[model samples]
Each structure stands twice: as structure tokens, then as C-alpha cells.
Target: MQSRGRYHRTVLLVLVRTVWIAVCAAVLVVSGIAWSTVSTISNGVERSFAIPEDAPRSSSGRNILIMGLTTRLDLHGEPLPDDVLRRMQAGESDRGGYNANTLILLHIPASGPAIAMSVPRDNLVPLSSGGEGKIKEAYGRAKVAEEERLQAAGQHDKRTLERAGREAGRRAQVQTVATFLNQPIDHLVEISLIGFFHIAEGLGGVDVCLKNATKDPLSGADFPAGRQHLDAGQSLSFVRQRHGLPNGDLDRTKRQQAFLSAVARRLKGADVSAMQAMIDMAKQDVVLDSRFDLADFARNVPTEVRFETLPVEGGARVDGLDVNKVDPEKVRKKVTELAKEPPPPPSNDGIPCID
Candidate 1:
């Protein structure tokens, strides 16, 4: 996603989700003076996909699902160039196989606190049908099965098949997560890995702090423990590094949240033109369903938007794969508490920086 590199690892597809909302808020702030920029981003806001017509919506708010996928396929379902593929690390895996590496459900209410609930990638959950599997695999499996079914039914165009297949996969993913959490998923935003890198670059870089020096070849993360600015590649590495951290992916989740807060700080001070450029660059990487207007919705959004992990019980093995386990009741309890929370504290910023 950061221009100057050989394309070789898709894991760097660190799609920082919270920034999208923050940037929307920023753009809205600059809309009066930056009409041209606002107009440009608004033009690309065309509805490109469908959500359930009968999807449940709360009178108080809506639940938006944001998914970070592992595949490098573009919106239309075609594979990207090898160099792009390699940089995104999509080349590490076969095409057409997409995993929801990051699954976050953001609850925006008309009143009270907003919740950014994160569902662990390796959580064990029931598939859309029956039986259990790593929740992340739901999309990939459904996509593959759908593609096969469509192919047999005589749909032969590669692009057409891929598109249809991905849609099935996305629906299954949304339904599965919604059912598991007992929440209605009202909308979605999908980000490609390459898009993630460019997005960070456009926004400048996120400020991050580490508790200790760390390095990881798998994710290509190397940093000294302290406060430092992270460019696109480094930002990707910071949130993408899982192996070296004490809590593994759980830690990376924090990195993601911290990055979002950093984004909020960055956007808060950016000039209109800078913010506009960031939005323009980001538009190239993000895919949305139903063209939800963040600026319009931002009006009713709770002043307190905070991120929290879905309460997890512990780790458990499902079908031989390690997974996070959660009690449904506990999750509901947390959601309830989140809904009643007061204005979010400034500490909404991520992991503490070690001086």
C-alpha cells in the first residue's frame, strides 16, 4: 500500500476501521470551506451492493459491520497484479479464498454511548447453517461453495462468477456474526489490504508507542519500545504483528484501536486540503454496501464513541483450531453496559505509551 516496495505480503492489509468514521467527521467539519473535496468523496458514495431489505434496525441506532478480509481480490472479483498481490501478501495464499481477518460491529445510537465491539478473528462460532468453525472462515467457505454452485449452474464469466461468489460469502459472514452476537447487522464496509496501506499514507502516519523493542519477520514489524510515528508500512506492521506480542492477536487488536485514536488526533488538526486528499486516496480502497452517509449519520451519533473487545471467556479448540470462546450472556451484558456508558473518556486512546 505504501508505494516504494516490492509487493510480497498481504497480511500488511491492516484495515484500520475507526479512522473511516473519524475522517467522515473531519470531512463534515471541513465541508463548508472544502466543498469541492466533500463533493468528490460524495460522488463516490454510490450504493454498490445490497443489504437485507428486512434487516432489523433499532429505533435508537444501527449496527454496522466492518470486515477486514485476507484476500487481495478487487471489488469486481478479479485478482490484482502480482506485484500488488505480493505486497498485500495475498500471494501467500490462493485467490478466491477470503477470510475475515478483522470483524468489528460498531453500534451507533441516537442517544447515549456508541460501541465499537470487536469479535476476535479466531472465535469459535456456529456457521450460518449449522456446525461450528473458526468464525473467520465462514466467508471464504461460503464464497467457494457459492462459486462452485454457480459454475455448475452454467455461470461461466470469470468476473461474474467471482462477484457472485464474493457476495454469497459476504452475506454468510454478516449473517453468521449477527446471529452469533444476536444483533442485527444493518450495513457493511469492506477494505482491501492494498487500500489499507494507501489509506494510512494519505492520513500521514499514526503515532504509536511500544512497551518493548519488537521484531517479527512474519509481519515485518520492527520497532523500538517508545513513542514514534509509523508510516503506512510500519503502521500495517504494528497492527499486523501477532506472533511477538504477549497476547498475540489480542494485542494487535489494541494496536488497531490505538491506531484509530491516533488517526482521530491526526485528523483533528489536518487542514481541509490534507483531509480531502486523505479521503480521496481512501475512496480507492474502501467498498461499502448501501452507500451509508457517515456525515449525515454523524449528526445523531453519540458523542461518546469508544472501542472495546467483545467479552471473551478464554481460548478453546474447535475442530483442532485454536479459537477464542465467549459466553453469549456475557457478551450481551457487555453490550448492555456499553449502551448505557457515559461520554467516553479522553483515555479512549489505545495502549499506554511507555515513557
Candidate 2:
């Protein structure tokens, strides 16, 4: 039982961290907050140079990449507090490395609902770090290489090394995804797994629906069919259950989409004080590109936001690693087609049901 519990917690941490792209956006500038509060929150957020000051702007809209690192470590590479680790049910600092397990691109067009595209982490593609590998590896690969270079250069402080290495990682990750999807990244929002738990806690909890009664020992998800509310831990379990699903990681992607949808709905009716508190929590976990304007985004954010996964040809193995096979041209064309469609109508539906 002890061994099983540890394995469960380990998988729980890995999978749950793969979502929460929504948390960064949804928590940062929910529509009703005061401008002063939004400005303060924006200023308090840690900034990154992943997107360059003179990077080419998107002609039609702004594209923001929200990268969620699988690392169990915090932004500064320190282990999370014991209390936080206990609450997250995650393992010690060694469990997850520096992979960007979750990559979501949000395109806020000049005049319509924003579209969020989720890119599966295991998609095999040419990485900016070197040759072909999982898209998720681009971050860690660049990070390690930069750290090694920095070590040779005599910058030996641990935190300083980690910070510089992470900046390289972020830049590589942003460029890799932009090349893959053929889009310009105007800004970036980076977070670690713990941010998911913190955002959920701020919401007080969330409501999710599953299509069938299910139990997954690996992810620690055991819930009955139909609409059910979950506390922060259970909410993590909710998005983490992919082992028993027919589509595996693909289904997990949909679960993440539904979760963000539910978050958006909840925020619409959330108390002003609660929203402010959530923003406060977010500032601790999120890092945004220096150029992102939170106040303008708060005022102009669309009422309807749509989520979809980038098309993958299928699954394949390369060098003994399982990866999603994606056709780059097909992906770019698909994105172009999606861009041409009119914004989707607002969903009056409540919590979305998922398998």
C-alpha cells in the first residue's frame, strides 16, 4: 500500500501539472477586477525575456504561449514547502524534471473570441535545441546546455545558474512552438505544477462532470458518473486520469479544455474579493513576458474563448520513445482554417461532461 500510494502520487503530480494553461490567463485578469488592482497584480508578476522586445508582432492578433513546466521545483529551482508538497500529494523534488509538459497557445484576434490551441507534449518534432525529439524536451535540453555553458564561464551561484538556464529554456520553447504552428508568439506566461493547486484553492473548488463512474489507481481519480464538485486535490485527480481513457493523452487534453471552460464560467459569477485573492495567488506562480498588458487584456478580453487541440497524424515510436506524429503543414493549414472561421457562439451550457 505504501509503494502504491507513492506511485499514485508521483503520477498524480506529473499528469496534473500538464494542464493549468487556463489558470494563468483566467486568474490573472478576470473581467470584473479594478484597474488599479490589475496594474498592481501585473507589476507584481515576474517578467521574462523569452519574447524579445522587438519581436515581430502578429498582424491579425496577439499570440500568447502559456508554458507549464513539469518540474516539481519552484521558479527559483527550490523545493516546494513541505506543507505545499503535502497538500499537492506530490513527491520530493526529484519527481519531475524541467520538461514543459503543457504548451498552450492563445490567439486573441483583433475582433473575436480568443482561440486557445493545446499542443500535446509528446509530439515528436524538430526541436530548437538540436535535432528531432519530443516537443516538450526543447525546454530542458536548452536549459541543461545553457547551464553547462554558464558553469564553464564561472557563474557558479546555484540560483543564478538556474535562472539563466531557465531563460534559455523558455526562449527555446517559445521558438520551437512558434515554428511548429507557424505563428508569432507575442507574449509568454510560464508556471510550474504547483500553480494549478494554488489557483484551484483560490476558486474554493471547481465543478466537473465525468461521463461514467471510474476509478484510476495510477492517477488517484475515483469518481461517480455525472456532475460532481471537487476540492483542489480531487480537481488535480480529475484532469490527471488518462490511463483508462480510450484516447489516453488526447482525452486528457480535452479534460484540460473542459476544466478551463469550467473555470471561465465560475469566474463570471465569482465575488470581487475572491477574484482579487486569486490574482494575488497567481502573481506568486506566474511569469509573463514583459510586454503583456494586463490592464488592456482585462478590459478587452472576449466573452467567449474557444479551445482545441492541434492535429496530430497519429502515434509512433522513435529511438524507443513514444511520440505523436504531426505533419507541420497540415497543422499550419488547420490553424489557418480555424482562423478564418467566425467566433463560436457563447456556451450557455454549464459544466462540460468528459470521459
Candidate 3:
């Protein structure tokens, strides 16, 4: 009887071990599937952009320009109404022109965290052509000129508008921002204003923290202190508000950086099941330059990337508009500092947008 009991006990132990092994194997398979799905969704959203294959490999690393086009061609190829266009052309009050309100330059070093620099839209800089204007105006002017030419040639208005918008996006803005970088910018990513809102909504909104109370009628943003979860419309207004910010454009640029950081954090936290939500968001309101391949890149971007903003001083104004003029000597020095192998820690505070 004792021998039989021992045999039965041993058999039961073996069975339990086998079951545990099977459970572990199943768990692993499910985890892998989930990870893959998340990666695919993220890449799909980003793949619309055109990333150059032969982009120069940097020993120190490469830079990417994340441009937000102010044109009405968000994901749906929608154009602004004629009345709105007329008001914008006449420089009427409250009419935001077709110009890039946000410009961010991302410097990804071969090693360490990525640095993001924001350029204020009102920055006064000499254009490639003689004379100075708001940096945002360059692309808008190019777009307007292209449309006028197409109209004069008696082309189909819709088709011509589409072509003109594309040309304006590629030639006027992206190229101009690259030129301003004064360094070899390897990749360019353009995201429309609507794209940002859709992405936020898709992710179930983003949490934003304001150090103080703020209100801006122009951007329709109103917030009172502390952490607040913002939906799509609120998120857009939060990042767009500039009038009430104490530092004007400088403060707005900082808010944008904070918002992007929050977004990156939120995306990293999303589970594999959220893939559908991501895909829906991309399909609805996102467009990318033709070079990026979402599937491939998504697999490689581990959730450990670091984010930093570009440093700038707010001391100048042009034509009553606040401008964060790039300190050439400071920028050159900073760039050189970044070129060193295993780049140094990012300087905290005083970073602005690259637009």
C-alpha cells in the first residue's frame, strides 16, 4: 500500500510541473503577440512621412525636423472656406494665416536622450531671399504664390490646389527649416494641427500640468492651476494659447514641449489592445511625408527614449511681435558640444521651438 501511494504522489507532482510549463509558454506567446500589435500600430501612424534611405549616417548622430504645417490640408485634404481665406489675406483680426505655428528640431545623438528645440513662429530672421518676415510667413507665401500661378494657367481649381499645397509643404517650409538648421538634418516629419488633436483623443486624452493659472482667448484655452486631463479640443487650445502666457511665444513653446513629452509618455504606456484605437486615429487625421516605414521602425524604438528641448534666450521683438532669435554663437557652440562622442547631458531650462 505504501509503495503504491508513493507512486501516485510522484505522478501527481509531475503532472503539476507539466501544467505550469504549458501555462508559461502560453503567456509568453500572448505577450509576444501583444507587443507586435502595438508596434505595428505605432509604425503605421508614423510611416506616412518620407524618410530618406541614404540619409548620412552621423558619427555623433542625425537631426529630424518635426514641422507642423498651418495649412488646412490636415488628413482629409480639406481646404479653408473662401471667406476665411479672404480674411486671412486681408490680415483681418482673429484670422490665423496658413503658416507653421510650431516648428521643432529634434537632435538624436548616436548616444543619450534626444534634444528637441522649438522655434517661435514670430522669430524674425532674414529669408534666403532678401528682407525679413515672420518665419511662418515663408511657407504660406510660397503656397499662395503656387495657387495663384495655377489659377492664372486655368488649371482645375481642386487639382491645382492639391498640387500647390504639396509643393508648398515640401519646397517652402520643410526645405526652409532645414536650411535654418545650419547642420545636416537627416529626416523631416510633418504633422498637421488636426493630427495632434486626433492622436490625443485616440489615446484617451493627455494629462497636462500648468504651474499657474492661464487664459487665452485667441487660442480658446482656459485653465486654472494643477494637473488636468484634456480631451482633443482642450489639448489643441492648451498648446495653441499664447496671448495670456507671461512670456508670450516663449511660454507657448514650452507648453508645446511639455505636451509632446506627455504624449510620448502616454503612448509608451498604452497596452497592445489599444492598437485599433491608434490605427483609427492615424487613418482619420494623420499624414506623413512619404519616406517613413512604420512597421520596421516601430520594432526598434524601445520605450526608453529621452526628450529634451532646445535652449534659447527671449530678448528680441520684431514689428511688435515676440521673437526668440537664435543666438548664432550660442547655437554653434551648442551644436559643437553635441557633436562630441557620447554627448553631454542636456542643459536644463531655457529651450524653445525651432519654427
Candidate 4:
């Protein structure tokens, strides 16, 4: 017969294991939502996407590009409803175009820490087809180019044409970022405003930390120093606000990272209800490029994902706009160094006080 102490310890162990399993299940629920459904086209254009066989990969490295688009329009370039616009708290009106406001290149090394490096939207770079402009504008330009090319080819199917244009846009955006960083990209995950809102709502609320009292009138973000929970509206504000941030766009980039950190943690334990809410919301707002297999990626998730910003000298005046000046080679070297660094100490329940 087992001793009383041993029996109690065994019972405690079982309870702990049960709770851990439940949490893992909850976290995976949101991840289970497929990206293929995230972008739907009624016009029925069946296209397949995959990385080239000779594309770079290593036994220890994986690079993925995760971008956030700035637009109030659906994938078809149509505007969202007033009610959703209000809930999203997106600062600007829907002008019916797209620009990548957030561009993060994530490096998940097979045997080391995962790094999420941010490339500011204002990073001025040469487009693949030639000419210099803010990197973010590539999406809109590519979409227009694809549409015109298809039209000239006598393919007048509007739905089919529009989806093709967006796919081309995705390809362009990924290439631009990858080339800028001098890195090879294997996958792309782009999330829209509505999907993000639903995701925040689905998770109940995401928790974020502030280092100092902050209020950005533009993004409409107001928060006190320390940790706090944010609803969908406020969470959007938290990541989008840049006007009052100390380093302007760079600080906003950091905020985006902190928010994602919390989201990464929340995703691990988000209940079925929360996951379903995001799934429902995503039906109209998320796009996972055809090459990525979400199920496989989720199952082989890294032990940790850390966020950082690419090295930059600072902002400079260019074409009457403040743009971040970055050395592509230097940035690439920095990331190569990052791959070998150890992961930071275990974060709080989520990342803490990321001010």
C-alpha cells in the first residue's frame, strides 16, 4: 500500500498534468484556425503557391515574414462596415488601398532562440521592378500591376483577377522584405485589422505592459505605467500609437513586439470560445500565403519567440518625409549574431513592463 504522503503527491502531480494539458489545448485552439479560409474569393481562382526547391534552408534555421497591413478594405479592396470601423478604432478612413504598416521578419533557429525582427515601414528601399520608395508601398503597387497584367491578358473575371492581384502583392511584399534583410524567407503570414480585432476579442483581452504613462492622440492609446489588460479597441491603439512614443516609429515597433509577445502567450491558453471568435472573424480578414502549412508549423512551434528591431542610424529627411535609414548588410549581420545569443530569462506570464 502507498504511504499517505506519496498518495497526496501523486494526486497533486496528476492535477498539475491535467491543468497543463488543458492550457495547451486552449492555446492551440486559435492556431488551429486555417489560413486558407482567411482569404476567400467568390470568383473561384484556384492557384497554388510553394517555395522553390533550391530556396535556402538549413537544419537549424527557418525564416518567416509576418506583416500587418494598413487598410480598412477587405482583400477585394472594398471598405469594411461602419460598425466594424468603429470597433477597430483604426485612425484613418478607408481610402481603398493597402500598405504594409508592420513588417516583422521572424527567425526560428532549430537549436536556439527564436527572433522576431521588425523592419520599419519607412525603411526606404528599391523595389524589385526598379525605383525607390518607402518599402510599405510595394503591396499596393504590385496589386495594381497584377490586375493590369491580367486585364491585358483578356482575363476579365473580377473576383479571380482581384485575388490574383492580392497574391502578387503578397509575393512582392515578402520579396522586398527578404531582399532588404538579405535573408531568405520561407513563409508569409499577413493579418488584417478586422482579424486582429476579433483575435483580441476572442482571447477575451490581451495583457500588455507600459514602462511609462503614455497617450498617443493619433492612435488614441492611453495607458499608465505597469501591466494592464486591453480590449480589442485599446489593444489596437496600443500597437498603432506612435505620435507620443519616445522613439517615434521605433517605439511603436517595440509596442507591436510587446503586444505580440502577450498574444503569443495568450494563444497558448485561449479557450475554444476565444479561438472560435477569431476563426469567425478571420473568415473575412486573414491571409496565410499558400506555401505555409499552419498545422505543421503549430505542432513544431519553437520553445520561445523573442522580438527585436533591426539596427538603424536614425531618421533622416527624404522627399519631405521622415524615413528610417538602415544599412541592409549591417542589419543582416546583426540578425546573424542574434541567432547565436541565448534567449532572455523567462518572461512574466507574458512579457512584462515592455515600455
Candidate 5:
């Protein structure tokens, strides 16, 4: 009983953390408010030039890359305030690097339902940095290299260097995923670990259902089986715990997908005022491509979205690191098949039961 409970809790955390970026986008696109209002709120939101200007876009639909970084630092690469850090329990800023731990490719066509597909972080593939490695490493590797190159060229300003390094990281990550999936990236949304925490807080709390009652001390998750509401901190814990899960990280990934579906359902029912308030709280933590127009994107979005995890052949070790082995051709084919299907009907009631 304890073992199964842990597995469900782990899955919940993984799903929730990975899909925070999608939820952020949903807030912008589903707020059901005036474009001018969205534009006003987004006035000073950070923008990235990761996607190239001349990149070919899908004439049929839009593909958005939602990435979650492992870093605990603020977007500016500075340590978070002590109080905020304490609230997050994310530890000091030095703990994590810029690895893109969560990657979800969301495809929204000119018609039909939107599809949000989660890419496992440990997938071994050819990277934009020139050699093959885990897909998640593309960001940090490029960032470090760019920072070094800049320092060699006599740049000493910490903020300037940090910004430049991160830009390089973003470019590498975008290119890597695009090439892997054989899809053009129409937009990019990047958020850090703290972004996840802020998003959960902004939502007030999220409704989640677990199949088994569980206790995970590491994640501070202790909840009974069945449907329930989790506050910001508890929500984070529910999505972060993988230690006691039966399938470990894989279960967590499944949870992330389920969590996203639940969030989308919640957003669909939210009033414009509530969504606007959440967007205001989240804008600081989000980094969208400069070309992205929230108003325009929101106009075409369908109320229904389906979430899935791309199929992986299995796992193997490369350079002593565990990685998911995936066939690129197979992945592309799967995506094509999914894009052709009609979307499922929107649901507003029961939480997505996860275990």
C-alpha cells in the first residue's frame, strides 16, 4: 500500500512541474479578455530571440515549445531572495544549472483541438551544440560555452554576460528540439524552477486526484486518496516527489501530463478577472519569444487540449548517465498521426485521477 501510494504522489509532482509552462500560456490565451488588456499586462515581460527570424513556420498550424529549467535562480541569473527561497524549499541558487528539464511541444492547428506532448528530459539525441547528448544538456552546455567566449573577449559585466549566455542556451535548446522532432518551432516559452512555484501560487491551488493515499517526507506530500485541493506549497510538493514512486521518474512524467490536463480544465472555467490576476503574477517568471502575440494566439486557441508523452523505445546508459533512447523517425510519425486526429471534448468536472 505504501509503495503504490508513493508512486502516485511521484507521478503527480512530475506532471505538475513539467506542464507549468503550458499553464502559463493557457492563462494568456484563455483569459477571455481584451487583447489590449493582455498587451498592457505583458508590457515589460521578458522576451527571448531564441527562434530565428527566418525560420519556416507551419502554414497549417502553430507549434509552441514550452521549457522548464532546473535552475532555482531568477530569470536574471541572480539568487532568489532568502524568504522566497525558504518558501520554495528549492535550496540555494548554486544547486542547479540551466538544464532544460521539462520540454513540452504544443501543436495548435488552424482548426480542431490543441495537442500538448511531453518530451522526456533524459532523451539521448543529437544536440544543437554539434554532438549528441541528453536533450536537456543542450541549454547549459551552450550557455557555459558562450559565457566563456564572452569573457575571453573582455566582457566583465555579470548581468550582460548572464543574459548573453542564456540567449545562447535558448537558441541551442530550440534548435535541438526542432531538429529532433523534425518540426519548426513557431513560438517558445521558457521558465525556471522558481517559475513553477510562482505559477502554482498564482493559481491559489490546483485540484488533483490520486489513486492511492500517500506520504512522501522528501516532498512533504501527505494526502488521502481521491480528489482534493492542494495549496501552492503542497501543490509543488505533490509534483516534485519522485523518490518513492513505483516507476520513479517515468511515473512522474505521466503525472505531469495528467496535471496539465487538469490545469487546462481549471483554466477553461476561470473568469477573466481570475485569469488576469494569475497572468499578472506569472508574467515576471515567463520568457516568451519576442514575436509571440498573446492576443493573436489566444484568438485561435480551442477550448479543448489533449496531453500525451511521446513514446520512447526504452532506456540505456551513455557516458554513465541514464538516457531515454528514442527513434526520431518514429517520433515524427507519431506526431503526424496525432495532428490528424480530432480533439477530445472539454471536461470541467472531476480531477484527472493519477497514480
Candidate 6:
């Protein structure tokens, strides 16, 4: 009887040892899976862009140009209005020339909420020509120059127009705008109304609060006073409406900033399902400049970043059109102060190209 009891005890001890081994193996498997998941995400983000080997590493600081283009093509093959299409085809609109709807310069310091300053399309600046014109006209002038060059080269009308459009799109517009910003722009990202709307919808929606009831017939936006959740279309109209606002473009600029802030806030709190939706939306809606690495940048966006508009008094009529302009000297001084870095002594340094 004693021998049988001892044998039973030994078997129980063996069973416990076997269970311990199985638990350790299960833990190892789970740990391996977790490590693999993290590594895969990191690699996917890093490989999204072909960054230059010699590109300056971000010094805990970043500066980006956020341009809102005025194009009307939808990501999912929807067509724009016939008149809008005609304007684009005729090179009279949607070409990023005299009709650039929105221009914003965003500066992200090594630490802080990003500062965005709008350059009134009407601010007069020295053009490549000795004469001066509205800031909005600079790109148009460049487009005209490219067209002239193509004509001089004896290109056919259609070919000349195409080449001119490409050249105009690739020129130094961003850099010129950067000069107006009074600092070097480290990166640039352009988004259209359609793209913005798609992104907002993909994230479910964004909340916007207005102090008073507002309506804009042209933009098709109507909002009652108080907090409300805006869908994709409403959000677009909210940011794009200029008329009826007390301050016009200035007020619109503030609204744009607010919208972007809300979007960023939503993204920060997004769950896995929301992130997947965003990724899918980007695959369809985004057409980035070749230099942008969206995945990497998306993953690295700082949570503590703040958002503010550039200092500007208001809007005024320039050259028969209402436009916004930045005081060059004032902008320079403000940027220097905000950067907390002394401005370099005045020199006639030429502007850099947007590579």
C-alpha cells in the first residue's frame, strides 16, 4: 500500500512539471507574436518613402508647408462640374496660378503647437520681373513664362500647354511662399477639398462648435449655434466658406485652423478600427508629392503639438480683389521671436528651390 501511495505522488509531481513546461511554451509564442507585430508596423512606416540618404534629419524640429489646392476631381472617379472642368482645361482656373484659393505656411518648432500663418493672396511682393504684383499672381506669371518658352521652342499648342502645366506645377511656388513666411520650409504637403472630405469621413466624423448660428449659401453650409458633429461634406464647406463671415478670409483662416486641430485631435485618439479606415481612405484619396512619406510621418506625429494662426490684422481689397497680405518685416520679426533664435543679419540670399 505504501509503495502504491508513493507512486501516485510521483505521478502527480510529473503532471505539475508537464503543465509548467506547456505554460512557458505558450508565453514564448505569444511574446514572439507581439514582437513581430510591432516590428512589422515600424518597418512599414519607415519604408513608405524613399528619403534621401543625405536629407537633414529632423532635429526634434519640423517645418511644413500645408497648401490647399483648388481642384475638383474625386478620388473614387466622381466628376466635377462641367464649368469647373472647362476652367481647368482652359488654364483659367484650378491651375494653382492666380486662383490659388488657400495658402498656409505651417511652422513646427523643435517643441510646441504648430504655428500656421496665411499669406494673403493679395499681398504685393516683388516678382521675378522688376515690377511688383499680388502674391497670388506669382505662380501665374511663372506659368506664363513656361508657356512662352514652349512656344519659342516651336511646340504644338496642345504639347505646349501640357508642358507648361507640368512646369508650373513643379516650379518654385512653395519656396517663394516660404520666403513670404520668413523662414525655410522643411516639407510641403498639398491637399484638395475632396481629399480632406474623404479623410474626415473615413475617421467617422469631427466635432465642431460654433458660438452662433451660421449659414453660407454659396458653400452650402448651415450650422446652428453650439456643438455639432460634422460629416465629410459639411466639414469641407465649414472650412471653405468665406462670405458672410465678419472678417472674410481672416475668419475663414481661423476656421481652417480649427478644423485641422479637430482632425488632429481625433486622429490622436483613433482606435485600431479607425486607423484601418484612415489607411484605406489614404490609399484612395491621397496623391502626395513624391517627397512625402505619409506612413512614417503619420506614426511619428507628436501628441503635444499645438496649433495657432500666423499674426495678421485682417483683409483688404488689393487690385480690385479682396485679399490677405502679411507685413513682410512684421512676419520676419514674429518668426524670429517664435523660433527663439536670433535672425541672421540681413543679406541678399536667394530663395531655395522646393526639392
Extract clashing residue pairs from model 2: none
Ranking of models by lDDT: 2, 5, 1, 4, 3, 6
Please write out the lDDT profile of model 6 over residues 1-355, one tens digit for every residue: 6554333323222211111111111111111122333333333321112123354434536655555555564322245566644422322224333334566655555543444456555566665433666665655567567767777888757654644543364244554665666565556544445556655665677777777788888676788877788877787778777777777766776676566655654654555555555544444444334455433443333323333445665566765876555577887777666555423322422211110
Task: Supply every candidate's count of residue pairs whose N, Cα or C atoms clash at under 3 angstroms.
Answer: 9, 0, 18, 2, 3, 3
Query: In model 1, which regions exceed 4 Å deviation?
Result: 1-19, 22-50, 81-96, 271-276, 302-304, 342-351
Q: Residue 68 deviation, candidate 2, in Å?
A: 1.4
Candidate 5 ranges beyond 4 A from true positions: 1-32, 215-218, 265-277, 342-349
Q: Rank candidates, TM-score, best first.
A: 2, 5, 1, 4, 3, 6
Model 4 regions more than 4 Å off: 1-59, 91-93, 151-157, 346-351
Instruction: For candidate 6, report its TM-score.
Output: 0.65
Model 4 C-alpha lDDT per residue in residues 1-355, reported as the tens digit of each score: 3343333322222211111111221132222322233222211222225345466653457777776888777766677878878887884455426788888777767755567778888888887646877888888798889899999999999888878887777778877877787788876666666656666777787888788998877777989988889998998888788897778888888777676666656755555455455445544565654555433554454555566677887788998988878787888788777766734745455456865
RMSD of each: 6.7, 8.5, 12.4, 7.8, 8.1, 16.1
Give the winner by lDDT: 4 or 5: 5
Residue 45's lDDT within candidate 4 is 20
Model 3 C-alpha lDDT per residue in residues 249-273, reported as the tens digit of each score: 7777767766765564464455433
Query: lDDT per residue, candidate 2, 5-60, as tens digits?
Result: 33332222111221233532333332234445446666777888888887777888
Question: What's model 2's TM-score?
Answer: 0.88
The true-versus-predicted C-alpha distance at residue 175 of model 1, in Å, is 1.0
- Distance (Å) between predicted and true CA of 296, model 6? 5.9
Displacement of residue 61 (Cα, Å) in model 5 is 0.5
lDDT winner among the candidates? Answer: 2
For model 3, what is the error of residue 231's alpha carbon versus the real structure, in angstroms, after optimal superposition?
A: 2.1
Question: Model 2, which residues run further than 4 Å from truth?
Answer: 1-33, 342-348
Q: Which residue pairs of candidate 6 clash?
A: 113-306, 114-306, 120-324
- What's the TM-score of every candidate structure? 0.83, 0.88, 0.71, 0.80, 0.86, 0.65
The residue-level lDDT of candidate 5 at 196 comes to 61
Pairs with steric clashes in candidate 1: 7-86, 7-87, 8-86, 8-87, 9-86, 9-88, 9-89, 10-88, 10-89
Model 5: lowest-lDDT 10 consecutive positions = 9-18
